[model samples]
Target chain A: MAKGPNVNWLPVKDDNRPVNLDLTKFHFPLPAITSILHRISGVLIFVGTAVLMWLLAESLSSEEGFQRVGEWLQSPIVKFIVWGILSGLLYHLIAGLRHLLMDAGIGETLEGGRRGAVLIIVFSVISILIAGVWVW
Target chain B: MVSRVSGATNLGRNGLHDWVLQRFSAIVLAIYTLGLLGWFAVNPDFSYGAWRGLFDATWMKIATLAAIIALCAHAWIGMWTIATDYLTSLALGKAATFVRLLFQAGCVILIFTYLVWGVQILWGL
Candidate 1:
């Protein structure tokens, strides 16, 4: 890692808190980054809801409408979008479950929270990739 | 430990509600998605009457209705929590809440209405 001159990475203690200067002063920590991603996933789900609903409506309308939707879905572009939506759904589900588990008094501690956040990302990526395989 | 009891209780209640529905809806959606894809694969030229007939099965109608309702509610609760977390302004959060409630209500009504209409179609009403 390249650091500019006069950069002092020190383990400074504040009050009784252990300050890992590399983590605190340099950049956002893993847990904070995952927390932000959780919010982003939620927003993605909100937007994807409209697309899924539109597809459902079209499919259920009539035979022609069904065919139309099917044909539209057959296109590679639409298929990719469908895959993207499903991936988003899978990721959101994993992240949401992580939050739920945290709420259940499971991972509120600093170390526990960090581990859980990493697990959320790992699970989300795996589930989303599985969904992508099924969709695409 | 003692002071956190109340907060823990609240968290458990809310998280359990969302978690249970999310799992329940995912199960239904998994079945529904497979069924839909299979139907399309088997019958390429699926017609209106055929479509009606497919949905005419009592269990199929009920299952699909259940899926739609669960999906809507699960999505609603999930999205609501997300909105509340992100939107700091009280007015914006309230407005978002109102809109989410309306959307959820509309989704339920639409699904139930469609189910009833399908029943009518099956019964020649």
Candidate 2:
């Protein structure tokens, strides 16, 4: 029989003491950063979906409704908002695909996960730039 | 030494289901988004007629409805996870958890309303 490494098992201690820690001083790794941004992007997309649904409903209602949405899209502020929404969508989509790939066991290793995160950021930035040009 | 309980309840048993649904919805939304963007790119002059014509197709209407449903599912799970993970507060007792549940429920109602409204708009009914 093959020998295995020894393990140490410790008994649990009852401790309800409060521990103060500063989150601002913490350093986030690439994968952690990507994961947090994915959550943030999901929230952004959720809010943006509301706005998009409203626009779709308005545009599909009648000719006047369509014209109203068309006119609204012509404003610079509206365009900016659209750009922001698109950027969020792009990043979310890319990072989300990475997550899916990870789920499929493609990037399960630490090194692979880091590389995937970097690729997500790079690709998303390029896509967002393209979306900005298209929107404006 | 503290006594350890072997049969402690698992908090994350249902999380796996939500995780799978989120990923599934994400795939659907991604395809719909890319397809919509491609349609827009190919047809630069997006007039009212063009918009109406696109949605008038039965297939397009069905796809759009599916996408909307997927979006709702995806958003609900995402928001629910975020709320549960970040809304805990020791000082506020269970207030944070209560508020988180309320917000999630509100979001579900809003999303369902939008989904119904979107379908009506798509079919012009």
What TM-score goes with each of the models?
Answer: 0.53, 0.84
How would you encode candidate 2's per-residue C-alpha lDDT over A1-136 as one tens digit per residue?
Answer: 3332221122333433443333455688988888899899888878887788888888887889999988998999999988998999999999988888888899899899889989998999999999999987
TM-score of chain A of each: 0.74, 0.82
Model 1 per-residue lDDT tens digits across residues A59-97:
666677778887897789998988877776666666666
What is the TM-score of model 2 when looking only at chain B? Answer: 0.82
Output the worst ten-in-a-row residue range by lDDT, candidate 2 chain A. A3-12
Looking at model 2, the pairs that clash are: none
Q: Which regions of candidate 1 are displaced past 4 Å?
A: A1-26, B1-57, B70-85, B89-125
Most TM-score-accurate candidate: 2
Docking class of 2: acceptable
Expressed as tens digits, the lDDT of each residue in B34-103 for candidate 1 is 6776786688666767776777688776777776666565555555555444332223433544554455
lDDT of 2 by residue, B19-79 (tens): 7777788889999999999999999968888898889999999999989888887877777
Global Cα lDDT for candidate 2: 0.78
DockQ of each: 0.11, 0.47
